[model samples]
Target: MLTTRLPTKVEPYRLASSGKCLEGVIPLADMPRVVEAIGVQESDVRISLTFDIDSQRRSFIEGSISFEASLLCQRCLRPTEPEPLSSDFRLGLVTSDALAAQLPGEYEPVVVENEQLDLLSVIEDEVLLVLPQVVYHEEADCAVSRDQLASGVEPEASDAPAVNPFSVLRTLKDKH
Candidate 1:
């Protein structure tokens, strides 16, 4: 396991040729983009990646990343830990959308810029894509309930009588 900052840019051709593997922990603070999206960053992200060339001779990398993150449950407005965040991906490099579209569905398209890949951004994108679209705590765990009503000891009478619109319509119909 390599315990160091991964190269900011990687030459896919040379890396895939060697079929190298790297394992390391990316500090949570280093992933500022992910922290902004998730709203909380605490644990270091464990990353393991392997470089390879697929059968079609396309340079690609496969890897898994996992971490523990805290998220606020929208319903409860309190913190909750999501299931351990982990994901596996195989990103195939392409310089153009047309080439990316031609790739097999199993391989995610990664458009390379200037023939280099930004490894940190790739990891952050993967994590962001897998996040839950909506957050909710278990019903029993929630502090707020839909049935709860405001404290009311008595009902105050209104100065004016309430009128039903439907009754007025009914009177008009009867008169006609």
Candidate 2:
């Protein structure tokens, strides 16, 4: 629902102090790392972020991002239909590793330099985290059939009893 374009860069500390909320869209093509990982994307990524200082006086950014993208189907080795991906995250803004380590477990630490943060990069990283490790279409829709997946032939059942490789080891132990 957010149609406004989000700013590419901002000072998280300043925004957190003012308790600002930003909602907007970022063109998917603008994120190089995401594009490289998932291939070309035509849809825009919708994002919402709220910056505030917690009771502990730690500056943090809470945000959610949603987008649609086509991922390569592992079974078919082709692009599957566009799938929706989204993630919600809480990140504590920190200037150093020690400060980051001090943050509570619930908040992931995001190190900022010169008080500046790249909003797009942060959003893109979240998108990557939410991407499926393996993608596949529904069985009915997949180009590769179940039989074809088994190399187009049903496995034959052998008449002989199954042999256990461990039987030799068992015999050796018995002799010992």
Q: Best-fitting candidate, measured by TM-score?
A: 2
Residue 105 C-alpha lDDT in model 2: 97
* C-alpha local distance difference test of each model: 0.80, 0.90
Q: Supply candidate 2's per-residue lDDT for 127.
A: 85
lDDT of 2: 0.90
| Candidate 2 structure quality by residue, lDDT tens digits, 1-176 | 23399998999999999999999999889999988998888998889999999999999999999989989988888888888888999999999999999999999999999989998888888888999998898999999988787755657999999999799999899998
User: What is candidate 1's lDDT per residue for 3-55, written digit by digit as tens?
Assistant: 55666567766778899887777766677777787765767778888989988
Candidate 1, residue 66: the lDDT equals 86
Clash count in backbone of candidate 2: 0
lDDT of 2 at 130: 93
Candidate 1: misplaced stretches above 4 Å?
Answer: 148-176
Which candidate number has the best lDDT? 2
In model 1, residue pairs whose N, Cα or C atoms come closer than 3 Å (at least 3 residues apart or on different chains), thus clashing, are none
Worst ten in a row by lDDT for model 2: 146-155
**What's the distance in Å from true for residue 166, model 2?**
9.5
